[model samples]
Target: MSEDLPIRKIIHVDMDAFYASVEQMDNPDLKGKPIAVGGGGKRGVVNAASYEARKFGVKSAMAGNLAAKLCPGLIFVRPNFERYTEISKKIRAIFYEYTDLVEPLSLDEAYLDVTNNKKGNPSASLIAKDIRERIFNEIGLTASAGISINKFIAKVASDYNKPNGQKTVNPEEVTNFLEQLDIRKFYGVGKVTAEKMYQKGIFTGLDLKQKSLEYLDENFGKSGRYYYHIVRGVQNSEVKPNRIRKSLAAERTFSENLSSEIFMLEKLERIADEVSKRLAKSKVAGKTVTLKIKYSDFSLQTRSKTLPYYMSDKSIILETAKDLLYQETLNNSVRLLGISMSNLNTEANKKIEEKSVSVQLKFEF
Candidate 1:
């Protein structure tokens, strides 16, 4: 431990099967049962599942039919957003009591910096425990907490002990903890990156640390540096309290699938209008236009293009979205079509770089 280095007390809290647990809490019959919180339909997907359902290979984002096959007796329930929002509010209220430096990643998970909490509590572990207790006593839900010196380590540690357990990686033990960690478990290493690392003989944090900075930079680009530093427990990213919304999107499932490009284009026009309205409501503009397509088989894909400048014009947004759509070879009948804007420029509306551009795109089959 260096005397000049600064250390922080960061904690990551994640709810245990949040949606499914909420369903079970509302109905005693659903408790200790294999339940999934989502509809069972040809195109529907599971949002969350209880531990009992998870034992049978049921997981979130899985197709409804596959989830049913994985667990024949699985119970499916519709989601109640109002109820979930109410409970999430209660949970966030508890976090604020301990520290105002709370960063919620989603409704079910968040990061808290309890380094100088309002509770005047010196122990980060005790603060996490107290918050968990409050959630259980007040809301009747179990949560897992990970406490460490930084956000990266804290997020990883939170998953070390699941379903109401907590793990703390103190400042002095960070190096050893990361060294023993598996490469697949690293936050930024996705399935594709993991395969690449396996081919390069980098299976663990220690192996990753063995790579030279030049090698990492040459091989993995910007993310290569992230892995290099993370392996040595050098992550310094702060737990941001108010993260700006990165994108504003709108989507809808069609009553029937459309195979005709002309029909699909009409539907997309409506979807683009919806997305533009949302961006306007949020007062945000983005450089990228992404088109989301969901097929009859429930598979999803997206295509995006980043422009030279930001704009929220409906015509331009729709034009770009249409281009992205026609570029993709539609292999299946489309069940849903959506358009979104990302690479968000959250700065207030200004004329600094506002300009008009035109393009003529004609769809032909």
Candidate 2:
């Protein structure tokens, strides 16, 4: 870590089981029950699971049937995007009260740069506390926050104390905090990557730091450099208020594998409709349409076509997907189908706003 590098107060705010929490808040009967906000049918995937359900190993993206088997008493509620979006707006509005450098990661979480803020508060931890308190009082839901010198550490810290709690890693504590951290807890390391790290005997941040840059690069490629820097607290990514979305997509897994094109058209129609609706909601169009197929054997394939002009209409999207579907003969039965749009109109090269940093500045814990 270099003392000359910039020090900015970054806070990551994540809503607690956002979709399930909203359902619980709206319906008093669901307050303490194990609830999942999504379809509970055989083919359905759990979008979000309440904390109560999580104790039984129910989690988002788990198959509804598996979740049901894990928590037999779980209740399922359909998703209401309009309601979630409405509440998300209110939460973001609260964030803007303190900082314009707010970067939303999703409807349920965001990164806020409050090194200098409208409230003129010098303590980022205090600001995070205030923000969480306001969300609870105003939105009728709980939120968790992480405060630190950068977005990565802040994101990791936020998970330390969850479901209506906050964690702060001070500037002086950053190195020790990260060194003692579990390899799996590092933000970007998923299950597969963690397993790979385990095979390489890198099970902790200290273990990761012990590997040479050459050794890591030889073993992990480009991500090797990323691990080297982030483990040593050298991430320089900023919070961009206008982060552009690169792509939009919608996908569904089926209860039964479809072997013929006739059976797929109906599914394609529904998938295209979803993609179109999402594109319209974002108010963006794309030039490329992609068809994703997941075979019954779990082999994945994608076919894409870049159009001369951008489009966001359901009819056009469905037609393009249909064309891609018919472009090739079925290699195997497909258990999942997806439609995606890329080269979006939202993509653009915009200058990132720069801020000045003072050398050896003091940051409150």
Candidate 3:
């Protein structure tokens, strides 16, 4: 097992219902009730939901009004970003006490490369348990950890036992673990991609492993190479600390396919508004406006426009996206639509402003 694997010690830690749990912790009156944290207004979507809410089928990204209908007694609490940020800092501090290679995926989850940790702990499993214990003892929040040789499997292992538990995928167990795992459950595979794999009769990691790299590449594009390697329990991407988001986006998969020009134009306006708000919170802007389209036939296409200056305001983002959408020729009735900004500029670079211009390029996913 040691001969076949590099034997790296990676750990992925994820907090359970972070925002919702924090709300419950800070307010005793909220305990034992189904609660969701986010904007709960008519147009808002849930950001996090307490475990109690899960019974009622409430989920993050679910429309708030829909969630209310599902869980009639559900409590809505506006997010306290300052508090969540404070807690996240404490959690990161605890991880840094073990290893400096901490890659934060979001405020509630991170990947830690503890191959050579400060504690001189040889057992990654023990280290993970120690970290979770520290987080719970110090912050009063439960965290789940996954331990393994690489980031991909470690992430998968972390989910095996969630909300205050941990799972370790040892070197000896990597092969069988991958074989039995469902394709849909793999870390990076999304619903659309999973459906594509299913259509090709690839239902599990074992099934995915049967395809040649050439076949995968032809069928799935660049991500095919990614699938080929991770299924065999081989992934070498380092746990990079201080990673910056390359793009900020907002997209929606409609309940029904949209082919009407009027319907799509309205959807794009709404999506652009959402994207602009996210960019504002991040205090960033970008020069590239990317429009992503997924058809009902499951085909995907991306069109992008790069402006001379960064624009994060809704009006500019909406206009640029509209331009890109109009230029493209839809191959089928659209099932999904997205707008994203890239070539990001942080708040520090906010001083430079230039008139927006559209330059279109096509990309395949």
Candidate 4:
């Protein structure tokens, strides 16, 4: 939409095997070993598996038993979410140092719009290199970055050189790169859609780009517009800062089903800490706090309470969540616990003065 302005510079940064890497970083002995950071018991799932484990056919979301069968000597450890959150915070602080137009996709990835950055770097590739180096030196983690004129190209470029690497796609190379890409590798083309495309002889970006808009729309519906633009290197998406949250939740699946109140309480404290940190980072406060419990049978029940005022403090959030949990009746052992904060201050008077100052600056600009 803002294409009339100077061609925008966007970067996507993704950490390689974030959870597995963090686990390996914490325990030096786990380095170069087939380690997974989830599931050590029956009915457990793998959250993340190291690259070494991946060589033996291990992957995230695979059943722990299946992963063990794939790699007989695989080591599994419970996730340390608190440590991961701490590291994410440190990395995000570094991103803000360069630009306020940072949009975090998750704890391990983000899109940065550096069109007019605080550091005044003209080249997005150099900024990406600096960010990746800073992350490695300061946070002890490997990050891969992609720099391009738009989000689509930037996302594709970032994956080209992964694990402490960076890649850039200039405007001139955009069309040629897309032409050779496999149809399946195009972003947003899932397995089912890719199979359909293959059956229709649309095996490459070149083939897709040749199809008329009406034809693509007939087959792919609303997403056809997206495909048309991306195939032609015409992405116009913006990197929006301070994106509002629809719902904020933190959850953990235990290594074993826990019926003990003490063990569950300890886990709740950690989850509360994570939720509080996210709330603080986003500068949001919620009036409602909900506690969710999933039983061993996979059935879930939730209980929530709304306070008169918004809360961002860790202790207050935990106390409120604990009270909600106490009020609910548990019929079975819980395999997972979740805490969500919602009903945000979407319209509060805190921004009135700020908006007035911004309006004045707009006229001056």
What are the per-model numbers of colliding residue pairs?
0, 0, 0, 0
TM-score of each: 0.86, 0.92, 0.75, 0.72
* Pairs of residues at least 3 apart in sequence or in different chains that clash in candidate 3: none
Worst 10 residues of 2 by lDDT: 352-361
Q: Name the lDDT of candidate 4.
A: 0.85
lDDT of 1: 0.85
Candidate numbers sorted by TM-score from highest down: 2, 1, 3, 4
Model 1, runs deviating above 4 Å: 1-4, 253-257, 273-277, 280-283, 294-320, 323-332, 347-365
Residue 172, candidate 4: C-alpha displacement in angstroms: 0.4
State the lDDT of candidate 4 residue by residue for 284-327, as single tens digits. 89999999998999899999999999988889999998998888
The C-alpha stretches of model 3 lying farther than 4 A from their native spots are 1-6, 249-285, 290-304, 308-340, 345-365
- How well is each residue in 262-298 modelled by candidate 1, as lDDT tens digits? 7877777888888888888888889989889988887
- Clashing residue pairs for model 4: none
All candidates' lDDT scores? Answer: 0.85, 0.91, 0.86, 0.85
lDDT of candidate 2 over 27-82, digit per residue (tens): 99999999998878877889999999999999999989899999989999999999
What clash count does candidate 2 reach?
0
As a TM-score, model 4 comes out at 0.72
- Could you give me the TM-score of model 3 versus the true structure? 0.75
**What does candidate 3's lDDT look like per residue over 211-244, in tens digits?**
9999999999999977887888777677879576
Candidate 1: residue pairs that collide: none
